[model samples]
Target: MHSFFRDSPEFEQRKRRPYSPPKVTLAQVRSAIPKHLFEKNTAKGCFYVARDIVCAVVVYKLGWAIDPFASTFGIVSVAVKWFLWVVYWYAQGIILTGWWCMAHEAGHGTLSNQNWINHVVGFLMHTFLLTPFYAWRVSHHAHHKATMSVERDENYVPRTRKDCGLPDELAAKLSDYHEIFEDAPIYTLLRIAVMQVFGWPMYLFTNAMGSPRHPPYTNHFLPWSSIFKPQHCNYILISDAAIGAMGYVLYLWTCQVGFAYFVKLYLIPFLCVNHWIVMLTYLHHCDPTVPYFRRKQWSFLRGASSTVDRPFLGWAGRFFLHNVSHDHLSHHLFSSIPFYNQPLVTEHIKKVLKENYNYDSTNSFRALYRTFTECCFIEDDGDIVFYKNKNGKTARVLADDALDAPSLH
Candidate 1:
């Protein structure tokens, strides 16, 4: 990979001189989010909590349906029932995702007025999904406070070509995009599912990886950005205990109801929630145009609200993902406004921010696939550059050269 970049003239042209830096300022982006919206509070956060309760009830009902029907069925009928189980699995994913969103609201102190109420709700909701509630809450809030900051961002920092420790075998493999995707997808899934629950704990406990900056705080529930201190540690343990309790209950259910039926009808849907989570954050941050700031250019407001919006998914965004879509800019700004009021205020802020407000109505799934395939690694000049490869089509290489490789991230 180094040889390829070094040998190619285009790489030399695209290689960064010294970083010139971006023109946009933190004050400018902060100014875009209206002050009133930042302060706005709403009861709708309760609606999301209620929705999760309702969705769980519906899922339980569906579980009852699947179990009885599967048991009564013949071999072919059982196969058919299991196939229906896949659909239920998807529904379970959505529901768990919704529950996670509510718990996230609790993290943001949006689900209720009281701080203790938020902690209790978040702990309960996230524990069922095997997520460390306080741990995730702290990291995620840090993500908001430091969104696009390349150095400070909590999640999804894109590694530059120079930074990639690509050995010859891996470099040769990367030469063919297929091998990289094949390798990356496995890691991506593990990251999206296993890492958030398990890896999150290690980061909190050991200060290993994907760890939040440890802020000095006397209170775990109160708003103090940039650190995950000892005070919040108990909440994560509480979350783990809840998971242990749930596991024991599941064991009882398996014994009474039978393991095959238990897994088929109940567990599959529960795991699907991870899909929504993986997709949500991926699409939220991974736009072609989104800038990842270096430390000098980074600031709290710019980092907080630098995220873009997806079209049509707004309600679902708020409901299943907390008010991330609507209240996001304000969430970035204040970090205190509850999720329920986020949307109405976000819209109001958008009206105020106008062109300065970042949003993308473009189809996200298509873009996600394209970027995942094309922009896994970035090439840096003085500025960070994402490039599209030229495959005999008319191309836009920044320096107007037809190099064998085009830069991308």
Candidate 2:
């Protein structure tokens, strides 16, 4: 029976499969990389922050110059003016997002080896964008510490059918076939739009997609929330004060300029920052093939490997977002690695992990649609589980037994 099984076509197919985990330890993976890659150059990191800040300022000024006549073009139609404003918003937003990524690096202590510099730069960049720097830094640390753990991950926790509390009829409509064929494209687009526009704010205010923890509500801005400890209350208050000061500044600016002009210059671009952030994070962790692990099977390596890297808006996207989307796995593995060094580290990771590496080079919009449509709710209880469509069909499941199989090497 063993001989016959070995000779079967199924055995041949299994032998030809490409995906498998690395046989090496995390320390081994680290040892294989060049030691110099870990060295943080404060000057170089500050240069990047300065460059992004200057570019963002230039873009902001350009938009300000164009604002008054933005709607006054006689040769251009209203639609054209609207399109130009959109382009302006997107341009400024992408640059702002780059600043946000720099702050993110600061949070990871990659902006510079100096803790004070990282904190100072991170606080300023994040406050300008209205994000609570310390609050986000602490929570994001939790996210990295518990990436794919269903019980502890800090962001983008998928809901199950039971958790969603969807009525039977509504749940039935979310079935695989209905979502693809029966549901209107407009409905899906609208849902995506809502998520892009309001998801970040909602998460900050209500911790809408955060881990299911005690007290039922976990806000990022609140120190008393379960997301932070009592010791963090002081930093949270500082963050709130920073945000309040920025708001007051904006209010003073708006009082000088018209509210409409302020909205055009600042509010629209700010929304774009939120949109990019939400879309980037949502797509990073929400792939169908990625498994959410329960405590029984959870490990740091496993959790980190569960994230997939995606390309957004092509080269421009990578540039503006500081390769955050493209090299996310590397960032997850070594949070303190600088953005400039991420690509080099990521290549090394891919070489070591080989088939275990997960990268989806799909167009951003298509990937977004695929995740929203297929990667919905997951099973609450599982050693490993893929998300399921509304109809209760498993969207995608990893080959756990095979991944757990003995290393080919």
Which one is best on TM-score? 2
Task: Quote each prediction's TM-score.
Answer: 0.69, 0.88
Q: Which stretches of candidate 2 lie over 4 Å from their true place?
A: 1-22, 67-73, 77-80, 165-183, 400-409
> Model 2, range 1-409, lDDT digits (tens) per residue?
2231122332233224533445666776687678888889999999989889898888777776674565677667566667777888989989998889889999999978899999999999999999999999888999999998888888988886566654443445544435433457798799889999999998888887888774565677778888888999999999999999999999999999989888998999999899999999998898766678777667787778768777676797677788898999888988878889988999999887766577876667767877787776876566777777646666444554634644221
Superpose all Cα atoms of candidate 1 onto the true structure and report the RMSD in Å to 1 decimal. 9.3
lDDT of each: 0.56, 0.79
Candidate 1 structure quality by residue, lDDT tens digits, 1-409 = 2331122232233232222222345455446655654452335555666777888788777767875687777767778677777767766767677787778767777655667767887788887776667767777877776677666777666655443433333344435434333446667555445643343334444443342344323222332324555666666566556767888988898999898777676666554555556556666665444455565545564455456555425556555666565455556666666565566657666654554356554454544554454445444332334322211111122332312122211
Query: Whole-model lDDT for model 2 versus the true structure?
Result: 0.79
Q: By lDDT, who's the top model here?
A: 2
